[model samples]
Target: MIITEPKPFEDILEMLADVDEVSIIGCGRCAAASLTGGEKQVLQMADKLRAHGKTIVAEIVSDPAICYLPRSKEVIERLPKNGAVLVLACGAGAQSILEVNPELLIFPGTNSRFLGMTAQVGEYHEKCTLCGDCLLHLTGGICPLTRCPKNVLNGPCGDCVDGKCGISSSPFIKEEIDCVWALIYDRLKKIGKTEILSQTLPSRNWAAKTYKPQSIELSEEEIKQRGR
Candidate 1:
């Protein structure tokens, strides 16, 4: 899931200083799981915005699955009156809102964390890298790309200490999370897939996942042709 964390209320207020009226949109999926963009979070933001002297025209929680254009378009169009939209979701959700409504001013109220699992309440662990190409079938379903501090395609490096990865920080590493390779090995060994680890994986095909803002659309004619 695309985890996200809230931005400071004062920061949000400063962003909206020029806009007197605003709408608050929250996400119910990843941000909800992270406790950053759920209905409760949206209302809290609304309260905070009111306290800061901004007028709230409307408040609505976008479905956690707000990435869908049709659904998001409907919700966005119904947002009573919009001067500026304070979106409490991951960066993707904010973009989706913009795609649905091109005229409104959109402001993000949260920072997108890594793609990961919710290990426990109020705690999340980064898992998948959403690398476009998935290799979980061979890697015992654990993603090393995002979990490993070094993002090694091969086995653990000599620097790995006590099976824990030296991973930390965002956009750059400074702390340590778990060593995903160790987890992958244990999982593979348990399921009799250790042999898969013996094969040295090739260098990542950056061209596959490194393309910026990738998308493909099927025209109605293409859909009809494929249906045959």
Candidate 2:
């Protein structure tokens, strides 16, 4: 599941500083799971806005599932004149709503955190960077880029103490091992091959390897040949 968090209250206030009649739109899906911008949170936000001298024209309404099956049209039709929508969904949902109604002004209420599974009741940890490459096989399934405090690719530095990252004072360690490379070394020892650490990692190709938007298409002839 994708984890998300509500934007800071100050940021939200600044974003909606110009709006008078604002509609707080919530998603009954992912946002609700993270306790962000759900019906309850939206109502509370509306009350806060009213206290700040802004006129909230209507109560917050949450669709069953706004990210995938948005009821944006219904919400827009019910909005008061000159009302702007404060969307409490992921970035994709906000963009989708804008595409459906280009004239409607939309503001985001939550910051999309990461594509991660809930580690505990309220804790979420990122497990992947989607770097278009997979190296877990050599690293004992631990991603240093996402799990390590410094995002160290070469392993834990000399500063690591008792498996805790020395960079951040926070003792809230994600993995039991000191670092990904250490974990990999232990795994290799168990497999009777402790010499893996001597092998150096290839330098990453920055241009050919990036986490940016990309697209691919197949020609008509190729599609026909593939019997698609």
Candidate 3:
């Protein structure tokens, strides 16, 4: 699951300030789970925009799995004849909409948050960092990348107060807390293999944390061969 919070209304207003007519687009898949940019949210946002004296040309429309499917074109086609769009989907969905229709002015209505798993109902936390490598089996399925505040691979530092990370002041272990490491420890202890924590882990690749646009290229010959 992907978790996201809606961007501030003030910021949204500023982003669409120049546009006279606005159309709110929503994704029914992931955004619906977080209740951010789904049908309900889009309608609410449209009403809010109307209250702000903006000419809302149409009601909100939500598509199922807009990010992975090409059906988003239908929604785009239904957008006001000549109005800006405020997309309420993940970053990928927003980008896809823009790619499909470059003429349409698109704006993001929600922040692209982390790829996470639902800890419980209505509670989602990041579980993977997509670091180009995975070491869940070695560490008992606990990803230090997302679990540890500092991305510490070795172990919790001395500053860990009651299992909470000192760096971010995040609670270490709560009464119903879902600490992946703690869960792994408990499982290992039950299996009589509690010494797994004693094993040292290799240093993490800091390069993975560096922000860089990764791209793949194909030669002209290859493109021609593939009939591109």
Query: For this target, which candidate reaches the highest TM-score against the unseen true structure?
Result: 1
Model 3 spans > 4 angstroms off? 80-82, 119-121, 168-183, 206-211, 215-228
Q: Global CA lDDT of candidate 3, please?
A: 0.74
**How would you encode candidate 2's per-residue C-alpha lDDT over 72-178 as one tens digit per residue?**
55654555544578877778667666655676688888898887776666777678876666777666666776776666666767867665556545467454545
Clashes of each: 7, 0, 2
**TM, every model:** 0.87, 0.70, 0.78
Residue pairs with backbone atoms closer than 3 Å in model 3 (clashes): 163-172, 164-172
| Model 2 poorest 10 in a row by lDDT | 173-182
Write the number of the candidate with greater TM-score, choosing between 2 and 3: 3
Model 2 alpha-carbon drift over 4 Å, by segment: 51-83, 169-178, 183-198, 208-212, 215-228
**Model 1 lDDT-worst window of ten:** 166-175
How well does candidate 3 score on lDDT at residue 105?
A: 80
Candidates sorted on TM-score, descending: 1, 3, 2
Which of 1 and 3 is ahead in lDDT? 1
